[model samples]
Target: MAAPKPGHRRVLAAPIGLALTVSLAFLPGTASAAPQNVALQTSDGPQLSYVVNTKADAATIERVKKAAATAGGTIVVAYEKIGVLVVHSANTNFPQQMRTIKGVQSAGATRTAPLQAAVTTEIGAPEYLAGSPAATATDVPGAEPLEADQWDLRAIGADRAAKINPGSSNVTVAVIDTGVDDTHPDLAPNFSKSQSANCVGGVADTSEGAWRPYDPASDYHGTHVAGSIAAARNGIGISGVAPGVKISAIKVSDPETSLFYPESVVCAFMFAADHGVEITNNSYYIDPWLYNCLDDPDQKAIVDAVNRASLYAQSKGTLHVASAGNANHNLAAASITDDTSPDDTAPVVRTINPRECWDIPAQLPGIVTVSATGVQNIKSYYSNYGRNVVDVAAPGGDKYQIPDTPSKNGRILSTMPNNGYAFLQGTSMAGPHAAGVAALLKSTHPAATPEMLQELLKEQADNPGCPTGLYDPDGNGVADSVCEGPKPVNGFYGFGIVNALDAVTAP
Candidate 1:
């Protein structure tokens, strides 16, 4: 793939910041507004919103105290936390106003939209082939030679951890995608029922529920992604990056259509953050909108919410990783400018390359955005690149046809839903490899914060065949020589390709 052309940074044109304010006054008839709350996304944690109370003022407090004295109702839950207040009333019909509430200017519920399911097709069992391998020669006492017909799990770093007893049994990685097939023989053993949820359209048994665990639906994308993250390594057709790590399958996408809405993504992020998932993998992206300022009123509010949620997860040390995008455009490029006049003269010229830019949630700050690379450690022909936006790259595979050479086909081989296997390609396939590696690093370094883990991974990456003297115009380059360029991190290959052993043992 060619390097992205230089383009100007275009900030998104939207209002994203505005403080929320609320006002409340007592009214007749005690009907309530169904517990108004706002899901706030913070930089330091997951989602948190305020619970409004109509009787929080000094006068109301006094009245409540008197009412409790008279009614023998004492406040059990304390609202001592600043900006947090609660009210209790015996009048089921107690009339309360919700017009004014501090820190809560509006009452809106946030939910994750539906995610599209991944398509699945059978690729058959592995066939041992006589060819050069990516890793050093090692012997599995009783294991059979890997089948060539099977997907190449080892090339993408899954086999390394598998050799060391699969993964740490205690760790569970969250796969927040379309629902998964929990009954698959290769995946059932490592799936955790307590940590799974099908958040698709808030429905049960319908099309949305088909992706839920034990459901007879074919929503296999999450299963595939999860299998790649931690498929059971019990002498099966394939192994996962963290074979022993239990999987928390959170189905947020649709099983039939591969489509997902933004709200669902937000909900999924919050769910993972709130849960004890040490690592969350997002292999999807939204179309890129030109630079929207970090403080646009609406954008800022949404981003602030997301950042707050991420911050909350980080507080507990959860790592969030996503795919940079498949579009081969510079992430920092300016929006397309139309030069043609009114329709009478000539046609208007709009930008032809939409996928050229990095998509949202991935482009969101603080999240790891990964790109894809092919065999021989070169960038994948369809993989996107941006020194400023993409944080790293991994072996996602390629499909190049070389004359008389059995066509060098590239596809990421990993576990799928049901008792089957599959070959997937795309940055989607690459992101999970990185996520699994991050999980391994987290398991190895229990005390490290998410931020620390990210830094460590970059610091321990291994540089392969990157070019020298290819300066990034953005001035983000830290090293001058390709070999010496910023030893641990850079825009392209964010710290270079991940080194499993180095990341697992980093000081």
Candidate 2:
């Protein structure tokens, strides 16, 4: 998901920002340096985004609001329930100044980039082969034209699950990413427009089609993810994992940079929780830091705000399924080198302790963290994994582990904007497959809580156990990754690969 890998059509690299591995010793000032200097910019300086966390009480919130105003910050949206406020201020000192306030728990800027900068993200063009028809109605009875190309669906038994149950229309999975094109023929049937909204700048914009991608051509990430979760089984394009469940779009990615900042992501979680959304598929991480460290003030603040928001959503019965990131680092490792932080500005290479620095929403408690697998049901080469970190595994595709399908493309194929289709690979793609299965479980057990659904999902998965001998998929003599734990639950496959057939059929 970190910027599309070189061979893919496009990279929805929000959650997996630069998911490549690089080694560097711990930089001395990396954790100690302030995110930004207040002296560098005054009240008249460039506008910046900040998150202020406080006690979730009316009195405390009010006091913080006043303090924010006095610090030269304007309230973008106040999530009073979580006591998280998205603030905009030109005062570079606002974060430092707000920290001094009595009620403020944590305060920091969300990014290094200014508000007006037209951040450029290299979004690969949508891939389409002219005259290459996806499929015909006669190919697979009720299956879509591209159904044959979707090895991912069969790998997880989603193709068979459809016969038993397509999922409950009452259950909805919110794709909280770039945006979703509900207008796509494959997605329109099961799209929940009423529940969808654009939470771009910490505000919920419910305008008609407000959840549509800012630019369908390049902002196709969310739509692709949505298609994998709930694209209808109509004889049109590709079919999603849980083709009968409803899906809503909560656009949180910035239009220009395609970045999912903390404020927008927090707003999205709060929106989904309040809107009766049963599940959320978080394919993108709250950027610019790949790992939000507890030691860093700004990073810690991001961790706090996002944790609060996710907790609020969970309490409202919203089960969160997130990608474990594309970086192949062992999440449970003692130390990991991350060269990508503050991606909106210049990134600093630093060594981080995984225990303290986390890949939020995914590593956060209660989230069903997913790692990617390929056609062979082995861990994808680029998926991040840890024995206790990953909750489940799903088909996110592997170019090296080619499938025997017609397309023969080792990537997940799903609906794109403007009736298009493309192949993408990442834990971003894997999370949706698990999310779709969760939707099926929710559909079957209408009264199940988020905890219950998670348990059921894990119970129903097929544990392949750890791979025999060296776990090297690319066949390199050197091990690409080490598999830890017992077969039932390991770093590479978690509780093992998700089973869609079991999801809908289990008692």
Candidate 3:
């Protein structure tokens, strides 16, 4: 499938009257309450996942168990209505049979997969570029400087007051994406102390001794994303959003092929959540095949699991930041209605009528859904927006002009894969930038809860594209009026482009 293109459009449709419901099965298991922290039931039982479709009942449970048994495994979790079952394979050979079982559906490796071999061909390391040591280093050839770097570190400052702080040693941010180039001089110093299993699969080669716990694959997406968050700022290459921060690389997606299963992604999340990591950044979005409300039961189950894991992370005081999605249509407005029309799977293209909304994961209550903005202080042409859905916007590079070009402003610069640098334009890139900013805030304000961190980020946001007075035409105060011209908290630029300095300094 082609990569999802970026663009935002108003979604005009009726509200989804159905409320998200959860069903209780067996007494809440350890995994159920803390989906992301999966403690092996017996140290031998397959890892448990707490996220299950509560709508599933006893009958559904029996059906899933029977299917798993036939496939030579046991059902760890059963999600009836959503059609998802977490099965632990007693043996590895039954993987194929497990897929064939009636309700078994797709399966992921119960054990960790190895990373792909690293590139044998040696390439000269790029010249290191010096950046301001006081703030985040922005050395990308054409990348714009972050306005937020000027402020004191929010989370870090808070931590200092409490006397419990992350001095270079305790702060770690996990970049769960394609994979990282451990050998990259710019990223090597900050690699985690111990490596973990690759949820995706295969062993990664570390020819230059920079190998960490992440799996290796052709995909450079994870590596690039990692660089942006915590690439080493040792006076070489470009600096990261949080230069003082360390990086934990977890390869969940293949950047080269963009091929990744939902199960692998979930496992990666669980791994990060269980381990003592401060934050996890996810740049990927939901697949169209699985986004349908009435799609395959297993697909729905996986989506539910992802949400569960996210909640679990939050309960641990660890934030799980995800991309709002590239689709321009309002997620709430777009849904799988009972209509049997032929074009049901077709993309939703309609203008939002007065007083309607749609969005996903972003719409998911607790998750932080970030939007994108360009240099001109306007919303990125590809950014999706809804007054209530998008929590905030950050600098996503613009395609119209060269980096630093007077008229062609708004592109954010950070490290790219292969020791090279390029201005990536998309919410995918924008989300991480904000995540990095959040990491910085978290470092400063150790006592701030995830909710508090989010609130501070919004309150300190610089309003743009709207008037100074109440711009919310909807009266909800959630959706600001676009007519007032973009302001810090207006619809076009949620809370105004992220002001790193203000976020850190705000009391």
Best by TM-score: 2
Candidate 3 lowest-lDDT run of ten = 118-127
For all candidates in order, the CA lDDT equals 0.48, 0.80, 0.47
For candidate 3, give the lDDT. Answer: 0.47
Would you list the rank order by lDDT, best first? 2, 1, 3
Candidate number of the best lDDT: 2
Tell me which residue pairs clash in candidate 2: 1-13, 4-11, 15-284, 15-285, 465-487
Models 1 onward score TM values of 0.63, 0.90, 0.63
Provide backbone clash counts, one per model: 58, 5, 59
Query: For residues 173-292, could you state the per-residue lDDT of candidate 3 as single tens digits?
Result: 777666667667667788773543365422232233232323332354566666666655465545566666778776654433344444455555566666777777666653323132
Shift in Å, residue 291, candidate 2:
0.5
Write one digit per residue (lDDT tens) for candidate 2, span 402-506.
998877888888888888788888888898999999999999999999989989988998878888878777788889989999988788878889999998887
Worst 10 residues of 2 by lDDT: 20-29
Candidate 2 lDDT: 0.80
Count: clashes, candidate 3 = 59
